[model samples]
Target: MNRVNQVVKMHLRNKFTWFLVPWAILGANFLINAVIATSLNDGEVVNTGAIASIFIYTLITGTLTLKETFPFAIGLSIRRKDYFFGTALTVLLVNTISGLAITTLSAIEQATDGWYVRLHLFELGFLKDLPFIGIVGINIILLVNLYFIGFTISSLHRRFGSMSMYIFFTAALLIGTITSYTLTHFGLWVEIAHWLANNYMDLFWWMIPMVGVYMIISYGLLRKAAV
Candidate 1:
């Protein structure tokens, strides 16, 4: 337990890891959107993809956490299991804080009528009706899912090699293409969309099991990974 905590501390030793980058990314996006909104002199500028930038940033950070920190942790005599768990915990903590902040910002954006510019940036429409806690929960779940996807990919690369990573992605693309083709062939596109519309919230629930699967796969790969 102490070792795990130590590993967690090691990741947090750099202030930029947990402190600066998230806000910087979000702030930059908000500033860009605000400027655009001002220039257009239009009505409310709704950015449906406003949150995407931070999510992508988190995904990239997840891979970097392993690529950069895993080697250092291993050199410090840290067990792989401890490092894995500690990284997972750090991701959870960081994303929870991020979720709360974003949720708060969304509420404030609504209260202020989009920072008084009528620019709907973070306070997106799909989530506008959800309660504050619900919004936070959704963000946390989505963030975790994205983080672990990157973590799992990096772990596989560490366990195997660049070639294996390429092969894995190729296989994934093949599978996705086949699935898409099957769905299209059956003409289930509209039905699928309707199903998703009916159960979009349920998608968040699936993230829990997806996160578990990612954890298992990442851990399995990490156990065999070398620095």
Candidate 2:
């Protein structure tokens, strides 16, 4: 078989890469959102709900190391560039699809929150409208950028991926969850939560560059994996 076809075939059939991890991640999101909607008051439409989706996605994308996934490319005889491009393509494709899904979801969320009247929400001077096609395009750009950043960072050094993910997640979980709990349940962390609510988007922007860094680093990692 031609090398390109082999790579395609491998990608088509790769169990670990396409099945277990991604599906499990998607399933986790589904289950959580379901529980949030059914069990919790003011669920699925709250910032906390959005945070859960965003956080899980961040952790999964951040922690996926090239070392662990390289094995899946074995016997494909593809060049490093070919492998990198192919893998990145798959990720982008998945992300674009996800963006469409999220756009539809956000519309539903808005309608629900608006008491089924589809109220226009002026969020910080931004329009509440998110056309499905527009959001799909936006998500495409987002994933491309994120993949580049993530690849660069992962490629920076071999040992940093999952370890970095673990440390950051743990610290944030400890502090953020406590803060969140206090804000929601006890009102003790109200001040901090208010401050965060005011600047959470700023915080999210801080991580975008890191994803590109990981993708650039993965370029080298892909070479090593090819060898």
Candidate 3:
């Protein structure tokens, strides 16, 4: 338990990576979108979707976290299991906090009428209709899911090298293409969109299981990974 805490501390030591960078990018994105929204006509709503930058940044950090820290932690005699748990704990804590912050900002955006510029950066579309807790829950789930996705990919690379990554991505691309083709051929896009609109939160909940699977796969790979 102490070892896991130590691992968490080690990762948190790099405050710039875990804290500053994502928020900086999000702030910059917000400012740029705000400026654009201000130039638009009155009553026109601008749904920038720039809020996604933070989540995407989370994914990048997840991939980089293993590459940057795993070797050093291993060299320090940290157990792989402890390191994995510690990393998971760190992400969960961070994402929970992030979720709260985002929800608060969304509320503020709504109250302020998009910061008085009609910019719908945070309170965009369907998310605006959800309750506070629901919004936060979805945000945390989405962030954690993206993080583990990157972590799992990094783990695969660590365990199997470049060739494995190539193969993995190739397979993913092929599968994605086929899925898209099939969906389009069946003309299921309208139905899928309607279903998603009605049960978007359910989709986020479903990601919880996949996040667990990613964690399991990452732990298994990291256990046998070379330093």
Candidate 4:
């Protein structure tokens, strides 16, 4: 337990990577979008979707975490299991904080009528009707899910090198393409969209199991990863 905490502290030591960078990117994106929104006509709503910048940054951070920290932690005699647990805890804590920050920003956007420019950066229309807790829950789930996805990819690379990653992405691309074609051919897109609209929150909850799977895979790969 103490060792895991140490691992967490070690990661936190690089505070810029885990903390500052994401928000800095988000702030810059928001500023640009806000400027654009202000130039538009009155009553026009701008949905920049710029809020995703932070989540994408979280994904990139996950992929880099193992590469940057694992070797040093191993040299310090940290066990792989402890490192994994520590990383997982850090992910939860960081994303929860991020979720709260986003939710707060969204509330502010609402109160200020989209920062007084009608820029729908955080309080997106699709999510506006959800309760505050629901919004926070969904955001946390999304951030955690993307982080673990990147972590799992990093683990795969660590376990099997560049060739494995190339193969994995190739397969993913092929599968995604085929799935899209099938859905389009069958005209299932409309139905799928309707289903998603009705059960959007439920979809975030479903990611919990996938995150568990990612954790399991990452742990297994980490156990055998070379320093």
lDDT of each: 0.87, 0.53, 0.92, 0.92
Clashes of each: 0, 21, 0, 0
TM-score, every prediction: 0.93, 0.54, 0.96, 0.95
Superposition TM-score, candidate 3 onto the true structure: 0.96
Predicted candidate 3 versus true structure: per-residue lDDT over 71-169, tens digit per residue: 999999999999999999999999999889989999999999899988888775777778899889988999999999999999999999999989999
Model 4's alpha-carbon lDDT is: 0.92
When summed lDDT is taken over every stretch of 10 residues in candidate 2, the lowest stretch is 118-127
lDDT of 1 by residue, 48-127 (tens): 56678788888888787888899989999999999999999988988999898889988999998888777777786777
Off by over 4 Å in 1: none
Residue pairs with colliding backbones in model 3 are none
Model 2 misplaced regions, further than 4 Å: 15-45, 51-59, 62-65, 71-75, 114-127, 159-227
Residues 113-173, model 2: lDDT tens digits? 6323322221111225545565556555555565565545455434454576677568878
Pick the winner on TM-score between candidates 2 and 3: 3
Error of 3 at 141 (Å): 0.9
List the RMSD of every prediction in angstroms: 1.6, 7.6, 1.3, 1.3
